[model samples]
Target chain A: MRITERQFVELIRKRAPSAGGGATVAGLRHGLRQGIGDDCAVLAHTRQRDLLVTTDLFLEGIHFRREWQEPASLGHKALARGQSDIAAMGGIPRYAFLSLGLPRRTGQRWINEFLAGFLRLAAASKVVLAGGDTGSSASGFLADVVILGDVPRNQAILRSGARPGDEIWVTGTLGTAALGLAVLQTGGKLRRSHAAFQAFCYPEPRLRMGRYLRQRKLASAMIDLSDGLSIDLARLCEASGVGARIVEASLPRLAQTPLRHALHGGEDLELLFTVPPERSPELPRRLGGVPFTRIGRITLERKLWLIRDSSKIPLPILGFQHF
Target chain B: MRITERQFVELIRKRAPSAGGGATVAGLRHGLRQGIGDDCAVLAHTRQRDLLVTTDLFLEGIHFRREWQEPASLGHKALARGQSDIAAMGGIPRYAFLSLGLPRRTGQRWINEFLAGFLRLAAASKVVLAGGDTGSSASGFLADVVILGDVPRNQAILRSGARPGDEIWVTGTLGTAALGLAVLQTGGKLRRSHAAFQAFCYPEPRLRMGRYLRQRKLASAMIDLSDGLSIDLARLCEASGVGARIVEASLPRLAQTPLRHALHGGEDLELLFTVPPERSPELPRRLGGVPFTRIGRITLERKLWLIRDSSKIPLPILGFQHF
Candidate 1:
């Protein structure tokens, strides 16, 4: 017979009489007006600042295999995904709420390591770990990271500003992360110190570049290369009511890498942005050591085309998809 | 052989070309500075208002069994849990970020109904569904709701301010929701139209009462009864370094209900607060047609006891536990 509700309540209360409140909670940090043990957390924000909010979902099998990645890195990647969204908006992330669902039998040590990894990024970003929910999942793990950020009032850069004749640019070399993933997928025991392994395990977000571009009003429309060049560019085009013509030769890639990988690899976390023709000269060759390549230009026609040597053709837009 | 990433990307982009951007995104409403299709949602706020944020977790096989609840009610309950946190703090909820990890084969219709239910609460609360993350899960469903609200500068109530000798009060009758849950748990057929079912399925949050108490400076410390009186009040006392004493007969319970259910049932969503003895007379008997009863008084000692039939005894502090 199933235990009655009263009996269950009695067992739970007898086992843990302290309730959920405690003097300290993991993931608490400075700048949190209200910490754990409260109904809601209180945070302070300036009036003229535009708050940036973003959330990202990660599932056990869909996002990670758990066999190849450590708990710390998984935690890092989860927070990084949400933080990258803030970076793409040219906003400074300040607070984070992490909700997680843990499957039965996961060790408390696993959680400690995950929190350690998550808090590392939070501390680096100067973000306060404020509030979130976490409970047990019967089958597998799931996590959602919500980031709260802010920019100067009305200073947010959107994806709706690119027009015809704007110059398209990309930061960092393409296809490295894809190469890293390929290495990992083949059961290649690569040294974690290898560049490809690092790229796959830890994709650096371009937050500083986004801020510089937004503050200087350099980019007309901007989007991160989260879904690869072909697909994400289509979204940027769709948003701006314009088209794109990128030269295959202009894309910066690792030596001898396939052009397809450079064009189709996702998770690069680089910035793909457009600058008007007049301000194109103001663009620097390099921003903080990362290479900036002028890969294409916006066009009057609202479609994506690739200009190969001597001939131009339509390119199929594609990327990593969750559903 | 594993499907090539290129082929997978093509399939995904072809299937969902919009990349989840569309006319109808769930949990979306006004007060959204930037909606779907943006890198991050930008929101407007003021310095005079401190931001209130809360997140709640719901897991399959833990919070609710799918066999017992519909997708719509599950969605409603998920969002309501976070909204109640805002009400408990005497703040107005403004924005929401919902993250869901859906299991395989859950179907699009399940998603549609879930959003329908979630949006209903958003519309009623005047809360905007700003941004969130959603993805496919490998196993069971998990949902996390993050609510953003604001309270006037520092007027928001905390659980750590109740002093000794304060009159404790509670709003609404206790044990109704628990009765409804018990009915459902015992395999009894409960129509949605029944009062018991309504009490369980559609628990109304006491936002107006919390606000009135805050505006009038009437409550010293306030809490919501999500985890029953015994457990939740323990949290309040622990937070404030005080204790509480209550006459068993003073509690407002449904007629013919056992006192045990009134003390241990979770998810009632009623407000329990303390008012200073000097200003207890200023408290209203009814606010927004909800009944209020002076349940007992806070005491100088840090323990909980029930006075009954000329004798006092220790009350077992039992309610709900997630782990």
Candidate 2:
């Protein structure tokens, strides 16, 4: 049987060498705090800071189609995916390494444009392009971007920190990117100014909001909504050993997007987090021009539930999976 | 026209944002020390150590063929390429991040064997597989391995450190991996015990030897022989703004391998370094069971020369290049 992405990750995690606690070298302590299951692997870096590392693969056909994506948007999205991981963990992105494989038919202008889009985002995020490898591809173009970020020691948010009474919250609207994907797939001619198009092609990572929540100790647990709300919420619940109950009417979504899209579509790139009931009062109604909407609450049960009107039903664990 | 790998790297370097000096965040300083042209990007990690980061792409058709390579060796070689880069800079590899894209036909047993080989090497070198990303590939299997290593502060031996009158040195015999590749290409049946076959499948990174040379401060400059003697030497010369002259008779190679393979074939994973004339007497003939051979000397003129039968001729920079 073909191995799913989740299975592959689990296999590696089980086989990986355990860096128990931290290794002491030259009287310095550097150990891994989080590994395979988190948005980013957290490692002890300096005396007061922890390093955050995340790797993402953007492949042609699997992740995007070249005919539909502008080279600039492709580059921007590529870096954004990794940056979002840092944002999810409440860290500051510092360095980025990009490994690119280009087919023989690729031209210089395309590469230049791709770099332009990538560097533009890097400058905005203050991430330096440190080093990477390039090779000739026999198939389609592929890019793997590795991002390194820094967070305050012992304060970086994690997916497993949620408690039972925490309220589930999301930043910005979900399903817009998925709606944009639908538009693209249907060969619809939409301008860059279109909301769905913009969301799908140039999703912005909520770095400032993530840092704000982290600094104030507002979020007990957090994860990025890259793979839609339903599945991502399931992941957070799984890690925290809690279930979640979502109010169908309370989810923030675009008017044009279907409820199913908001619940199951992937690549939204928003932040999904939980705040303790007592600390939820400290959260602002809006932070950095993005609205925070509470749509659910963490439960003691070990299964996901969706509340529509007065009835509660099971929420399917279907986001995006490559089997 | 297609951009060569050198041109692509130069382009990125020219356009990449400079991390001037080191940035201070929360009273700690971290910054990029070297980037792009080196084997690994050197970053100032802590007060006592520097961080070395390198990324490499191993594509199915470009770097290996699935039919010819065992899955386990593919995994080992993928990690070896990045580890070799760390060794080239005289650093100790700490963590590795792998981004693997597998085709639909990839079997679970193949993956298990691959991980087995990978973890075996990691256990040997004390390298930890901290994190990685996995995805489904629409084409061939591609793996991108990122290795992070540590070196003493300001102690990384870079290619640009070579000076005129420095004696050129190399560790181990060259071109064995290339010879192995030739055997594999010809469909020749060779046992794993065969030196050439072993070299092709399981080339070891010279970590201990590199640390020895770096700690002793014997080498003026260093680079790993990844892309053959002539081209990698040319790269070192270009980086140092110096020249090199090689004595054809002094090259250490297997008697069965062709002179052309010894000179221009790649993937030896050997250390090619330069030492000052005064320090030459302190160098050992052998360390860690690997032989050290003097093959040439750095030149005042900015060109490469090969001396044969007391007659000197220009050495062509015709090592492997993908465009």
Candidate 3:
């Protein structure tokens, strides 16, 4: 049937009478009271703490290729990507929901394997899968994960917290994922010595590190590097109403050749933040054995600059745009 | 750049650091406590409730066609479908996360309209959109909405509550959406007088009613109708380890044509329920002007029977399915 989106939606609404309570499902009425129509859905849990909500989509051809991904790995990556967002906000993830679009030709074995991978990660993180919807697709497989986390009433981190004079730091190594992508594209096998390859295959969420920063009241602002360093840093700076200047020698780059990969490579999933210079020394060089490095500082200049050797250069604004 | 899902997930894990003490983000961990490998993620909540989680996916061509829907309506319907599952368990929805995969050719205006419709419904429902990831696609649109809800300690209503001899009840009108679909498919223009058409266009959720059912201590078992009556009823019966028998004349049908539509049509969003005989009459026939009817009774026969003018016949199942 050639169902328009509207007709499909109407079909969904028709099921309501048996759904539950009238007042509870009256989304429009409740939405007005809670400010639900904005960019994100807001839920007030306490006087100072309100939950912020948002969602994203990743498609097979648009985000990755099936030929390159094992079904299990695809499932794992989907949840991790969403979890990173909660980590970015310095929130503790409590629950997750996954919606998958699979083709008829996809086997039940594939579905089970994917769920196994996803559920494994979710269990390790203490993230519970709450609920979701499922359907078939004729095009390709699609996975969407939604995550819920809690932030302290007054301490939920935001991208807009950076200020001029704040020193910037990053967790773990960067650019490995991008370089890994290069290796995968070239069909080059990973050498035993190439830790970057491993870094690319399994990007971890720095939930513990984020929580520490929020609890210690260390970072003035923070963001997780899902996009490459240049674009994500630019985004953090933009949200903070500030600029940044990074020293080449200060960055924690992978032990790989092309330095460009470290700078512009995406999917790093690392935490980037700013602290007062006085607090930088008090911060550990590593947290839970993950290396940390001071890479840059916030600036009032409102521009992103990179220092290579002794030459300062302007960084490009481009990042991975799905479109 | 091409990225494999395994490669992508590995990168995500590499970036995330192990849990650290007293940090906001670092403290939250992934992977199960029993060390991964589970169908559901177990989460520890503040109220001592163990949260169980799962996700499902819905896609365009596979689940519904764009030619039959409106963008806003599609968005709203997406959220509603997920919400129904939450309601099925009599849980209170707290958060929602959406991941959308749109074709590159899809315009921003369509996205805005979809979000407008979605947010409008989400706001009313008090479902906060937490965090999701987005990417582009080459084919159709995909929507995955994840929902988080909480049930009281040991108070969750499950599909396994019905008993033999429990009377079955349904809330609101049935077959309207299916009829609406038929009309739309037959190229029958919608007349202002056609409530079925409106029902097919816009759906309401019984969130309040579902909550009420739970709070009032009334139903023995409940489920929402997404896949037509026969299929969903069978599911409910399966879950409860029982069977059912519906009096054909007692089954509510839309005033329009085709008794088949009411019997096997999908997307009604109504609640199918079972209650003990004594409590059946005490239950109102309608809520908020939506009608209710006694359609069947749970039995131990392990079969579903349709009673037509004192004659018994086996009812065939017809509904949407992935396989």
User: Considering every candidate listed, which one attains the maximal lDDT?
Assistant: 2
Question: Which digits, one per residue and each the tens of the lDDT, describe model 1 over residues B176-281?
Answer: 7788888778888887886567667777778889889988999998888887889888878887899999889999987845788788888888888999999989
TM-score of chain A of each: 0.83, 0.97, 0.84
RMSD score of candidate 2 (Å): 1.4
Stretch of 10 with least lDDT, candidate 2 chain B: B21-30
What digit string (tens of lDDT, one per residue) describes model 3 on residues A1-323? 13333332343334221112113221211321122211223343333343444454557786777766567667777877767776776777765655566665777567767777787788788876554445566787776666756666546676778989999899988887788778776877776356656566556778888888888888888878877788788878877889999997877876673667667777888888889888878788788888878888899999999888889999776667665
Q: What lDDT tens digits, residue by residue, belong to model 1 across residues A51-79?
A: 56777777888877777777888778888
What 10-residue stretch in candidate 1 chain A is worst by lDDT? A22-31
Candidate 1 stretches with Cα past 4 Å from truth are: A1-47, A256-258, B1-45
What are the per-residue Cα lDDT tens digits for candidate 2 across B51-150? Answer: 8889999899988898888988988999998999999999999888989999988889998988888888987898889899988899999999988888
Candidate 1: give the clashing pairs.
Answer: B27-B129
**What residue runs in model 2 are displaced by over 4 Å at the alpha carbon?**
A23-30, B23-30
For candidate 2, what is the total of clashing residue pairs?
Answer: 0
Model 3 scores what on Cα lDDT? 0.67
Tens-place lDDT per residue, model 3, B1-323, is 23322333243344333322211222223322211111122333323232334344657776677777678878878877767766665666665556566676777578777877877787787665543445566788777766656554345566778999999888887888888878776777777367676666566766776777777767888888877889888878887899999988887876674778778888777888788898777787677887778888999999999999979999888766654
